[model samples]
Target: MQVVGNALVALVAALHLYFLVLEMFLWTRPYGLKTFGNTAARARDSAVLAANQGLYNGFLAAGLVWGLAHPAPVFASQLKVFFLLCVIAAGLYGAATVSRKILLVQAAPAALALLVIWLG
Candidate 1:
């Protein structure tokens, strides 16, 4: 049970790290072009916004990592579930309004994390 929750935490952290990379460093290149369907120049024009978005991803990762390291209290589990839900909701909203792939890429891991929190 503990192992499962820990794995979920790690998974969520990894996903957030990936989001950080996409939003921070790669938002103005071919990677972002492929991801966000924008030209290089357009992506470059929004670097500051991308960096801001990346910071949120980093925050999510940090929260999950902190909960993973200190699981003595049930608060950790609760927080993990809460943050995952937020991520999922955001992903779903983005997917519905912006892109369908966001739902798959972002919400799926969150759903898995929710499962771990529920059962573990």
Candidate 2:
């Protein structure tokens, strides 16, 4: 169970890292525009904002990675909890304001991992 929880954590971290790249580096690209359902013009106009959002995603990924790599077990768990909560919060907000898919894509995994961690 602990191993499962940790793997889930890693999965979440990887997702955020992918998000970071998509938003920061590909916001205006064809793939990014298609992924976000954005018009080319709209993507160009919002590119900077998307990049900024991507940077924050990178921070979240970094935090999760830090939590995973921490030397102390208890502290590591705390760190993971904090960052997972942050991810959940962000996902909820995105679901409300942006798209419901955010809840499924972003929050659900973290929630599952949190549950696994708690049980483990």
Best by lDDT: 2
Per residue, candidate 1 scores C-alpha lDDT tens digits across 2-118 of 688679778878988988999998898787779888988888888899889899989888887777776566887777877788788878887999899988888888888788778
**Residue 9 alpha-carbon offset, candidate 2, angstroms:** 0.4
Report, for every candidate in turn, its global Cα lDDT versus the true structure.
0.83, 0.95
Per-residue lDDT over 30-95 for candidate 2, one digit per residue giving the tens place of the 0 to 100 score: 999999999999999999999999999999999999989999999999999999999999999999
- Regions of candidate 2 where Cα sits further than 4 Å from its true position: none
- TM-scores, all models, native as reference: 0.87, 0.99
Query: Which pairs, if any, clash in model 1?
Result: none
